[model samples]
Structures are given as structure tokens and as C-alpha cells.
Target chain A: MESLLRVEDLNVRYKSYRGELKVLDDVSFEVKVREKVGLIGESGCGKTTLLKSILRILPPNSIIYKGKIFFKNIEIIKANKNEIFKIRRENIGMIFQDPMSALNPFFKVKDQLYDALRYSVHNIKSQQDLQQMIIKLLKEVALSDSERILESYPFELSGGMRQRVCIALALTRSNDLLLADEPTTNLDVTIQEQILNLLRELVNKRGLSIVLVSHALGMVKEFVDKIYVMYAGQIVETASTDKIFSEPLHPYTKLLLSAVPRLTGRWKAEGLIGRLPDYVNPPPGCRFYMRCQQSNSNCKIKPKLLKLNKDHSVACWLYGDEEH
Target chain B: MKSLIISNETIKFLLKRGGSIIFTLIGLSILIFILARILPGDPARMAAGWTAPDWVIEEMRRKLGLDQPLHIQYIRWLSDVLKGDLGFSIYTKRSVTVDVLQYLPKTLELIFVAELFSITGGILLGILAGAFPYRLPDNVVRVMSYIAISMPAFVWAIILQLMFARIIPLFPAGGQLSSHIVPPPRITGSIFIDSIISGRFDALIDCLWHTILPALSLSFGSMMQNARILRMGMTDIKGKDYMVLSDALGLPLRLKIYKYQFRPASIPAITAMGMSIGADLGNAFLVENVYNWPGFSRYGVTAMLNKDLNAIVAVVLVVGIVYAIANFIVDLIILSLDPRIRRMSRSV
Candidate 1:
């Protein structure tokens, strides 16, 4: 499978009043054509930051210290304004976590979608063409009553409906890649399921390559074909979703899976001990070393991501010899 | 747009606002009337001069209807006002309405131009400052706005006059027209409009030229206030989810600022600008005197000093009415700009 997107040894830092916080350190990731990739991590673990880095949309204070993000053959970090805009307009679509705020409140659904279409698609000029295209997009997102939905402001719609509209908006300009940053995180559990199902349907129907960033291991389990478990700004492990769930390898992944509440209700859910290390002056080794129960002298050196099999990779000293 | 303007909800909103404005104007009129009456100078005695006998003052008082009880006087004034009569101005020796019609439009023109300059300039500067926050542009805007906002309008008026009118000699020192130029025939009372309407382009140019110093002085403080408000709003909005989405979507910076970001950021600035209308008019008194532009505020000030009760009352009422109307328009604009407000209005 040819890679549609690739991140090479990406290092991102945020300069704050306190210090330069290393947000993403040596973070390498890849997505193949029509592939669904999931990035699982706790909050502030650079999940969203990684997604934004791919799109080159980091905040003003952020510095891409070392990295190369390639959407196809184009290096996003080196691309000019027009090139980046074209790529964002024609190739990439993003769905934010909060549907309530992702769409602009001041505009109606029709206007927002129309703005996207007008900017991204060149042939769309006449009002009639715009309206038809908007209706078609709305229908694609499973929103019936397209006319009423088009005229209504975002606040007038329910959370589910707003998410659907956001999906439609993202699809308006995007043809290939969908960067969904916890799109269902802010929704009700039922609505979350529906949005996930809709995203699945979109991937199947349109052959879209998606990078789903979420903290819910269970949610990502049923969504993506491959999962990359992230810990402290680096991908600690990557495997097929089933493989990762069945035989979790990374210490952090094992802790994360163990942390998920069980249906049996034996009261066995224990959270991972210790908070994330301070990124301003992070440890010069594996970030999870302090928290790892099996940490030894060798853990003082940062572990390289070693491929143990065709579909499994782990970045830990324990898996270092498994590659051979 | 038509639906938004003419909807039943909008009508209800307008009616409610109109009713409130009428009541507010009435209350304001009553307050000003009492304050004017209690002021040290007696209108009748002032009208008669200090050397006049007590009998002459009494006769003057009777003629001016000041001898009547307070309630009776208020009732009479209210009834006359309801009947479209503003009564006579002893200061101008004409009907109060005529004096207002002659003077008010000039002040309004100055205010209108000043407000236009301030609002447009403020929003642009605010966008500039906000886009490059904490950078050189932002720092420059911050310092300039601080300087503009710290000074009173009249001081700016004097300084502007000295700089532009005397030092540069680019604009006239004072007055509405050059002594040599023929005044445009007064159709709408505003010299600029009347000049344009009468095809006296020369007079129009001269009117704009004379207005520059006065308008600049009148605008700077409020303009800076608007800039500060819009700057703050834009900075605050920059962190909003929609703005992040806009950036991520790679919408052009211009479109993002003007279309996506501007409306939300401009709400507080618009509200501030509306309220500043009253302040601008009050400040215009000194500005008018400095320019000798023959505006309503100067007329009203002169009337107050001479205790011209009818003129003072009329001026205050006019100012109050204008302020209320300006705020009403601001509300309407905000209603259109924010759909959330529109939805609330519909629910109401």
C-alpha cells in the first residue's frame, strides 16, 4: 500500500512564558491510501498537536523544531501559503472535537458550507449550483430535510445534527484525507456511536484516508484498522487494532488497556500511576520510564521504534531484540 | 434581509424599544427640566438684565410663564411638546425648533463624519493590531490608542487646530466656510449636504476641508476606545474553536478576519460606539466653540449659560432622543449580525 501521508522524525515545541515545552518529539507516523489510522492518548499528550502539525496549523507560538510532513510528495512544512491552502482546500478535511463550536455560530449552515465550496471548488459559481451542491453534501451526511437544515443556524440544531453538518462541511473541500480530532468526544454516547458509524460509512463509501485521534481505546478499537498508542508526545507502540487489543505490548498500552472500565463490574479499574513528565525539561530517555513498573538501568536510554513483525512495532527496550 | 427587517419578532422588538425610549426621554426631560430650573441664574432676571427693577423682572417672569407652579409649568410644557411646539427661545429670539433645525444638523454632520472615521479606522486598526498581537503593529496601535484615549476631545480639537490649521496651514483655522466663499443655500441645514444638493461642489469641498480638524479631534478618543474594544474582542476570539477551524481550513486571512472573525469581534465595539454618540455630542460643545462652527451643542451651551430654558430643554431632549435612536440601530445591527441573538429575539 502506497503511503498517502507521512511524518518523519517530527519535533514540535510550544514557546510559553515559562519555557519551550517539547510537545512532539521525534514523532514519526504514516497513513496509507484508504487507511484508517487511530492515535490513542490521554489529554495534552500531543494527539491534537500531532494532527495540527500534519496540517501545519499549530498555534502562533509553536515552532516546528525538526520535522517533515509529506502529504503525497509535497512537504507541508516547506510549502508556500498558496500551496498549503491548496492542499488544505483540496486534500485535507478536519472535524473538531466539539461540534457546538467547530462551526461558526454567526453563519447559517448553507452559508458555511457555501463558503467552503466557494473557496475550494473553482467551478462552483452560480447560486443555484451552490445550493444543489450543498443539498447533495447534506444528504451525503444523512441529514434529511436538507432545505430546513441549510437555513438553520448551528445553535438551532441538536448536537448530533451539528456534528453531521460539520462532517458535511469537512467533506465539502476534502477529497482524500480526513483528520478527525476526537470528532465524537463531546457528544453523548449514543450520538458518539452514530457519528462513528457515519464516519465509518464515509470511509467505506468514499475511500477516504482518515487519521482518528481519540483517548477512548474502546472507541478506536471498533473504528480504525491500525492503532498507534501514544505516550508523552511519542508513539510508543503501533499494531493492527485487534493485535494491540488482544496482546498489548508497550507498558503504557498495557496500563491504558487495564484502565478501561470492565463490564463485569468487579471494581478492577485502576488508573495509570504518575502524571505526564514536565515537557519543559523532560527526561532524556523514554518519557514513561519513571512510571513503568519494570524500568531498569537500560531504560535510561531512549528506545527506537523497532518493527517486531510485518504489522507490529514497539518503541521499548524490551522489544529491542525482538526485531532480529 | 427583508424578512429579518420586517419579521413580526423584529416589529415587536422595535415597538418595545420605541416604547422604552419614549419613557426614557420623558424621564430625562423631567430630570433636565428640574436641574435647569434649580440652576443659580433665574431665566426671567437674566432675560431682563441686572439693572432692571423687580417689577420688570416679575413681568418678564410672567411673560415667560415662570410664575406658574412647577407641575403646571411641566404639564404645559409637556402638552406643548406633544402638540409639536418647542416654544420660544429667548436666547435666539425664535422658536426653539427653528434654532434646533438651524444648528443641530451641523453638529450631527460633524458627529456623523467623525463616527464614520472612528468606526472604520478603529475596526481596521483593531484587525491589524489583533492579527499581529504583541508584535510591532500591535504595540504601535496600543500606544497610539492609549494616547488618543487619554486626552479629552477639546484638547485634541485645540491641538489639531493648531497643527493643521496654523502650522501646516492646510485647513482653515475656524468657521464653516472661508470668508471669501459664498455659503451654499441652506436646504437641509447641514452645509455639506446642502452644498452637494445645490451642486456647489466647491462649497462641499470647503465644508469637508473646514470639518477635518474638528472631526479628527471629535473622533480620536472614541476611535481609540473602539480600537481597544475590537482589539480585545479579536484577541479573545482568536482562541475560539471556529477561529481555529477557520485557520485549519486555510481560509484567506482577509476573509477570516472580515467575514468569520469581524462580526463576532465587532459586537462590543459597536455597542460602545453607539453609547459614545452621547459622549461625542457633549464633547462637541467645546469642540464646536474651538472651531466656531455654529453647532447645536454650542448653541445649547450658550442657552444654558443665559438660562434659555426652552432651548436647553429642547437641546437635551434632542440629544437624548438621538442617543436612544443610535442605540436602537446598534441593537438592530447586532441582531442581524448574530444569529444567536436573532433566535432569542424570535423566541421573545
Candidate 2:
């Protein structure tokens, strides 16, 4: 399958008062055409940073040490401002964590969506066409009262409604790839399920690729085809969603799976012990060495991500001798 | 239908705001009346010279209604004020209301021109400072505004007069216009407007030339304050999540700043503008006095010094009304600009 997006050896650092914090260290991943990928990690593990780095939207103090991000054969890392803008407008759409803050408070829903449409899609000809398109998009998001929703400000809407509007906005220009950075983090469980289902339906119907970043392990399990387990700014494991759940290779992945509370009486939940390594002065070798129950003397040397099977890979000394 | 709905909303807002403003003005009128009466010098005694006999003073007090009980005096004053009778000035013997009207236009013209410059120039400088915070332009504006804010309007008036009028000789030193130029017919009483009505270009030029120094001096502090407030607001808005979203959507820089950022950020700054206007009116006393411009501030100051009760109360009432109205307008602008406020108000 042709990859829609590929990131290679991406290292991102942030200048802070203490020191240079290594946020994304040699991160490598890929999203194939129409594929749904999930990046799962604990808080402060640089999952959101990876998504931001792809869009080149990191804060001013952030420094990209070494990386190559290719989107549809275009090297996005080397792209100029105009090219980046065009790429963001035409190729990629993003749904932020907080829907309330994402939409401007001062603007009506219609005006905000109109601005998004104006910048992202080039084919809009007139005001009437624009309105029609907006109404149609709202309908796609299952917003039946499109006129009222469009006319009202974002503050007037419930959290679920606002999230739906945000979804509609992301799908406005028919973007090829949608980057959802914890889209359901600020939502209730019921709304989270609804949003996840909506995203699944949109991806299936539109044949759009998605990279969903989430901290919740169980939430993205059914929606995503592939899962990349991240720890301390590194992709510790990558596999088909079924394989990651059934026979997780990395210790961190295993720890995470064990931590998920089970309803059945047999399996006991075990929380992962130890803290995330301080990015300012991370360990010389394996970042998870302090917490990994399987860590050995060999972990002092960094282990490369080795393919165990056609659909499974792990970055651990335990899988070091595995064949690609 | 939309226009009808909007007008309905506007009317509701106006009625609510007007009720509060009227209440404030009434409270202000009473306060000013009490304060004016409690002033040091006796108005009746002052009206009569120092050598006047007790009978003369007593007769003068009777004529001015000063001998009446405080409540009767207050009631009489309030009733007369409600009827648009401001009474007569103790020193000049001119009707207080007419005197205020005659001198009011000069002060209004000065304030109008100053505020026009202040609002436009302040917002522009603020946008520049905010957009490029910590950059050279921002640094320059910060320094300049600091200087402007630190120096009082009177100090600015003196320095401006010295530099522009004395050394450069660019503008007139003082007064409304050149003494030699025959005054224009007093249609609105404001020299700027009256000169234009009378089609006297020379007089208009002279009026504007004389106004430049005083107006600039009067507005300097207010303009600086406005710039600082807006700059702080812009900086705050810049960090907002919507700003990032706007950028992510690939919206143009100008649209992001002006349409999205400016309106939300400007609420505090715009509200501050009303207070700035009131402060400028107060400062006009010093500015007008320094420049020898015949304005309400000058009249008010003279009345205060001479303990002219009627004139003092009249001037205070006008200033209070103007301040209250300015606040009301600012509230309306805020309601229009902010949807959150509108929603809150609507729900209430």
C-alpha cells in the first residue's frame, strides 16, 4: 500500500529554563492510504508533540533536530510557508482536544465555518454556494438543526454539539488526512463513543487516512487498524491492532494492556510502576529501563525496532534477534 | 425581519442602560449640589465685596435664596435644574447655563479632535506593538507610551507650547484663534465648526493651527493609556487557542489579526477609552488654562476658585453626564463586540 504520510527519524526539542528537553526522539511512523492509525501513550510522552510536528505547528521555542516528513511525496519538513499553508488547507485537517476553545467565541458558527471553508477549499464560488456547502457538511455530522447551529455562537452549544461542529469543520475541505489530537479527551464517555463512531463512519465513507492520538488504551482499539505504543518520546511498539492486543511484544505495551481494568473476574489490573523519564536528562539507553520488568544488562545499549512478523514490531532487547 | 429583531434587541439594551444612566446622573447631581454648598467661601458674601455691611450681605443672600433652609434650597435648585434653569454666575452675573453653552463647544472641539487622534493612533500603535511584541517596533512604542503616560497633560501642554509655539513658531501660542482675525458668526459656538459654516477659510486655518498644541497635549496621556491597554489585550489574545486554530486553518494573517483577534482583544481597551475621555475632560482644565483657551474647564476652574455655587454645580453636572454617557456607549460597544456578554445578558 502506498503511504499517505511517512515520518523518519524525527527528533524535536524544546528550549526550557532547565535545559533542552528532548520531546520527540528519533520517532518514526507511517500512515498508509485510507489507514486508521492510533498513537497511544501516557501523558507527557510526546504523543501530541508528534502530531504538532507533522503539521509544523510547534511553539516558537521548539527545535526540529533531525526529521523528514513526506506527505504524498512532498517533503513537508522542507516546505516553505506558502507550501505549508497549502498543505494544511488542502491535504490535512486537525481536530483539537478542546472544542470550546478551538472555535472563536466572538464569531457565529456560520462565520467561523465560512472562514475555514474560504481558506481550505478553493472551489467555493459565491455566498449561496458556501451556505449550501456548510449546511450539507452540518448534515453529514448529523446536525439536523443546521440553520440554528450555524447562526448561533459556539458558547450556545453543548460540548457534544461543539465537538460535532468541530468534526464538521475538519471534514469541510475534504481533506485527505485528518489529525485528531485527543478529540474526545474533553468529552464525556457517551459523547466520546459517539465522536469515535462518527470518526469511524467518516473515515470509512470518505476513504480518508487518520492519525488519532490518545492516552486511553481501550478507546482507540476498535477504531484504528494499526497501533503505535509510545513511551518517552519513542515509538516502543508498532503492530496490527489485533496483534498488539493479543500478543503485545514491548514490556511497556504489555504493562499498558495489563493496566486496563477488566470486567471479567479472572484478570487483575496492574498499574505500571515508576515515573516517565525526565526529558531534560533522560537515561543514556532505554527510556523505559527504569520501569521495564524485563530490562537486562543488554538494555544499556539501545535496541532498534525489529520486525517479529509481517505485522508486528518491537523496540526491545527481547526482540533484538528477531528477523525482519 | 433580521433588521427588526436587531432593532428590538438594541432598544431593549438601550432602555436597560438608560435607566441605570439616569439613576447615576441623579445621584451625581445631588452629590455635586451638596459639595458645592459646602465649599469654603460664602457665595452671597463673595457676591458682595469684602467691605459690604451685614444687611447688604443678608439682602444678597435673600436674592440668591441662600437664606432658605438646606432642603428648600436643594429642592429649589433641583426643580430649577430640571426646568433647565442653571441660575446666574456670582462673579460674571451671566446666566450659568448660557455661559456653559457658550464655552462648551471650545472644550468639546478640543476633546473631539484629541480623541479622534488618540483612538486611531493608539489602536494602530497597539496593533503594531502587539503583533511584534519584544521586537524593535514594540520596544519603541512601549518606551514612547511610557513617557507619554508618565508626564501629565499639563506638563505636555507646557512643553508642547514651548517647543511648537516658542522655538518652532509652527502653531499659535494660545487662545482659540489669532486676535486680529474677526471671529466667525457663532452658529455652534465652536470656532472650528462656525468658521466652516461661515466659509471663512483663514479663520478655520487659524482656529486649527491654534488648537494643535493644546489638543495634542491633552490627548497624550489618554492615547498612551489606550495603547498600553490594547497592547496587553492583544498579547493575551495571541496566546488563545482560537489563534492557533485560525493559523491551522491557514487563514490570512490580516484576517486572523483584524477580524478574529482585534475585536475580542479590543473589549478592555475600548472600555478604557471611556475612562480616558473622562480623564481628558478633567485634564482639559489644566490644558485650557495653560493655553488661555476659553472653555468650560476654564469656567469651571474659575467658578470653583470664586466659590460660585450655581456655576460650579452646572459644570459638575455636565461633566458627570458626559462621563456617564461615555460609559454607557462603551457598554453598548462591548455588548456588540462580545457574544459571550450578549449571551449572558440575554439569559439574565
Candidate 3:
């Protein structure tokens, strides 16, 4: 598989009224061809920030202090907003956490899809051409009532309907990479399943590389080829989904997986202890040192990601000593 | 029990707090009366002039009912108000309504012209600022709005009169019509409108020329506040994901800001016209005074100095009505624009 994106030594700092809060520090990852990479972690672990940095959509106050975000050999960090906007049309695409909010209230679904196609399809002369393109995209997203939905406002649609519209809009243009940030969090159980399945199918059928950002390891473990488990602002573990799920390396991953509610098991819900500490005045050394169940003397020392295998990595002192 | 809806719920909520309505009305009405009556010195005596005798002052007091019971006089005033008669103007000795109506057209005309700019032009500026978000133009507009808010209407009127009327001498300073020109036969009573209606092209031009200084002054503050509020509202809505969707879809930046952002942001400002319209009705004392425009501003100032209680009451009542109507329209617009209100309200 060829490398599609390479995020090297990425860092994001927010210059707030309070002080400079280092949100993302030295975070790096890569997505290979047709890869469904699941970024599983609690929010505020710099997952969403990493995604926004990819798109250059971070608010004005946020500063990218250090890093280079490379998209297909192009340095995204140096690109101006207009250049990024132009690039976003053909090279990348993103879906937000809340599907319902991902659409303009005043416009019809058809108009929204047409807007999405504006970056892809240039020189549209007639209304019928735009309509046909939108209808075709809607059909691809599996929305049967394309005509009616296109004419309706976003608020009028159901959650599943809106999510489908969002997905459809993203698919309107042939973008290289797809970034989904908790796309199914706002949906019902059945709808979440449907969206996840749809995303998996898109990745499988069309060879679309997706960066799936979510806390749900169980959901992504099924569809994603590789998994990156993040805590605080660093990736604690990176391994194939099968290896991560079957023989989880990091203590945090074990705890995170155990916390996932499951059926037909005597396993009781042992909630992860300790609160997310205030980002300002964060504890020195290892961020998870206070919360780690098996914290030893070496655990207090900040650890870099230690490569355990060609396909797996773990950022823990315990992993440093282990040969397996 | 009947089914509850948004409008019904809002009405019930408002009506339930019946005390607030009554209290507001009483407070306003009392303030109006006190403002009318207790200004500085003896008004009737002022009208009587410096050479008039003590006996004449006594006669004037009796005739005008200044010597009568204040409460009895207030009741009689309220009764006359109910009958739509504003009583006699102590200065002109004409019915206060007739005096107010004769001048209303002038003030309303200034308000009408200024309001056009405040509503249309001010909103357009706000939309431009909002569309760009953190752009340089947005920052410029933001700063300008603050400046607009800080400057008083009267000061602006004076400056305008000095620049355009006095020094530049491009336009006349005061009066609804040129004193040299024979006034067009009163068609709509408002000189500008009547002039336009009668196809008195010269009169129309003259009316506009005389109005410029005062209208510009009065509209300055309103335009700033409207733009600021509009910018704020637009900025907030811009943060919402729908805007991103619009951008993602590749909607024209112009269309997104003008059609989507401006309408939502301008709702409050649109409603604010009620207060400005009402304020315009009362007249800007400084603007009217500076331009020598014969609007309520001049009347109110003169009435205060002369202690013309009847004229003051007439002005206050008209001002209050204008204010109420402005707010009423704002409320209606708010209800229409926001669907959340429709769902949450117990009555529709």
C-alpha cells in the first residue's frame, strides 16, 4: 500500500486569553492506500485537532507551533486558506461529529449536494445538469427519496436522512482522503450501525482511505484495517485492528476495551477512574501517570513511541522492556 | 381545555405577567406627565413675555387650568387622550394634536429617509463583515460600528450642517421647505412626500436638500448599533456547522452572507426600527436644533424651557406609541424567524 498522508512531528497550540495551551505535541501518523484507520480515544486527546489541522480549518486563535502535515507530498501546513480550499475539493473531504448540523438550514438537500459538486464540476450552464448530478450522488448514498429530500431543508429531515445527506455530499466530489469525526455519535443505535456499515462499504468497494475519529473501538475494530489508540495528546498504541483487539498492548487500551459494554459476558462495567485533568497546569512527565493502573518508577518518565513490531507500536516504558 | 400552540403560549405568558405590562405603562405614563409638567420654570409666564403685567399672568393661569388641581387636570388630560384630543397648546393656543400633526410629517420624513439607509445600507455592511469573518474588512467594519455607536446624533447633525450647509453651502440648514419658495399646497402634509406626490420636482429637491443634515445626524448612532448587532449575530451563526457545509458545498461567499447571514442577523435590528422610529417621532433635540428643522426635538426643547406642559404631554404620548409599535413589530419578526420559539411556546 502506498502512503497517502504523512503527518510528521505535528503540534498545535491554542493562544487563549488564559495562556498558551499545548493541545497537540509531536503527534504523527500516516494513512496508506485504501486504509480505514480508526483513531480511538476519548475526545480532547487531540484527535479532532489533528483532523482540523489536516484541513487547515482551525480557528484563528489556534497556532500550529511545530509540524508539517503532508497530503500526497504537498505540505498542508504552508498552504494558504484559498489554496487549501481549492485542494479540499479534489484531494480531501471531511464529515463532522453531528450529521444534523452539517447542512445549511435555509437550503434544500439538492442545492447542498450541488454546492458540494461546485468544487468538482466546473462550467455548469444549465439547472438540469446540476440537478442530475445531485440526484446521481443522492442515489449513490442510498437515499431513495432524492427528489423530495433535495427540495427540503436540513431541519425537515430525520437524523438518518441527514447523515445520509452528509455522506452523499462528501461523495459528490471524488476526493482522495475522507475524514470522519464521530459521524455516528448523534444517531440512534440502528442508525449508527447503518452509517458505520455504509462507511465500511465505501472503503471496501471504492478503495477510499478513511481516518475514522471516534471513542468506539468496538465499532471501528470491525471495519478498520489499522487502529491508533490515543490518550491525552499522544498516540499510546498503534497496531492492526485484530492485534489491538485480540492482544491489546497498552494498559489504557485494555481499560478502554474493558469499558466497552458487551453482551453475553459476566464482565461488569468497571468505569475508568480519575477525571480528565485540567489541560492547563497538566501534570509533569507522563500525562497518564496519575491514572495508569500499573504505574511503576519508569512510568513517571515521559516515554516516546517504542516500535514493538513492524506493524505495531506502543508508547510505554513497560513496552520498552518487553520483547514480544 | 384548548390545544396550546406557540402564539397562544407567548400571549398567555405575556398576559400572565399582567403586572409587568401595567407597571411599564404606569412608569412610562407618570414619567411622561412629570416630564411635561416639571421642567424648570413658569412656562405660561414665559409665553406672557417680560413686559406683561402680574394680572395677565393670573388670567393666563386660570384660563389654561394651571391653577386647577393637578390630579383633576391629569384625569381631564387622560380623558382627552382617550378621545384622541391632545388638548390646547399653551404656546400656539391651537389644539396640541394639530400642532404635533403639522410637525410630525417633517420629523417622520427625516426618520423615513435615515431609516432607509440604516435598514438597507447598514445591513449590507454587516453582511460583508460577517461573510469575511476575521478578514481586514470585517475588522474595519467592527471598528466603524463602535465609532457610529459612540457619536451622538446631535453632534453629527451639527457637523453635517457645518460641512454641508454652512461652510460647503451645498444644502440648506433648516426648515422643511425653502422659505423663499412658495410651499407646495399640502397634499400628504409631509413636505417631502407631498412635494413628490404633487410632482413638484423643485419642491421635492428643496425638501430633500433641507432634510439631509438632520436625517444624517439622527441615523448615525442607529446605523452603527445595527451593524454591530448584525455582525455579532452573523459571527455566532457562522460558527455553526451549516456554514461550513455551505462552504464545503461551494456556495458563493456573497450569496451565503447576503441571503443566509444577513437575514438572521438583521432581525433584531429590523425590530429596533420601532425605537428609532419612535425616537424620530419625538425628534432629535440637537439635530433638529442644529439644522433648525421644525421637528419635535425643537418643540421638546422649547416646551421644556417654557414649561409648556400640554405640548410636552402630546410629544411624550406620540413618542411612546412609536416606541411601542417598533417593539411590537420586532417581536412579531422574531417569532416568525425562529422555529425553536414556535415549538417551545405553549401557544402559537
True contacts kept of 3: 0.30
Query: How does each model score on TM-score?
Result: 0.93, 0.93, 0.83
The parts of candidate 2 lying over 4 Å away from their true place are A266-269, A272-274, A293-303, A321-324, B1-10, B346-348
Give the DockQ of candidate 3: 0.33
- What are the RMSDs of all candidates, in order? 2.6, 2.6, 5.1
Where does the lowest 10-residue lDDT sum fall in candidate 2 chain A? A315-324
DockQ of each candidate relative to the true complex: 0.68, 0.72, 0.33
List residue ranges in candidate 1 displaced over 4 A: A121-128, A265-268, A318-324, B2-5, B88-94, B196-199, B346-348
**Alpha carbon deviation, residue A96, candidate 2 (Å):** 0.9
Query: What DockQ results for candidate 1?
Result: 0.68
Off by over 4 Å in 3: A106-111, A122-125, A146-148, A276-285, A296-302, A320-324, B1-85, B128-148, B247-252, B280-283, B300-310, B328-348
Candidate 2 per-residue lDDT, tens place, B110-229, comes to 998899878988899999998878899889999999899999999999999999999998888899889899999988888988889889999999888888899999988889889989
User: What tens-digit string does per-residue lDDT give for candidate 2 at A231-296?
Assistant: 999899999999999999899998888888887884678988888999999887789999988888
The better candidate by DockQ, 1 or 2, is: 2
User: Candidate 3, after superposition: displacement of residue A139 in Å?
Assistant: 3.9
What TM-score does prediction 3 earn? 0.83
lDDT of 1 by residue, A1-324 (tens): 999999999999999888999989999999999999999988889999999887788888999999899999999999998899998888999999999998888888887887888888548768888888888888899999998988888999999999999898788656889999999889988888889999999988999999999877778899999998889998999999999999989999999988988878665898988999999988888999999997877777788888889999998888764442
Chain B TM-score of predicted candidate 2 relative to the true chain B = 0.95
- Alpha-carbon lDDT, every model: 0.88, 0.88, 0.75
Residue A44 displacement in candidate 1 (angstroms) = 1.3
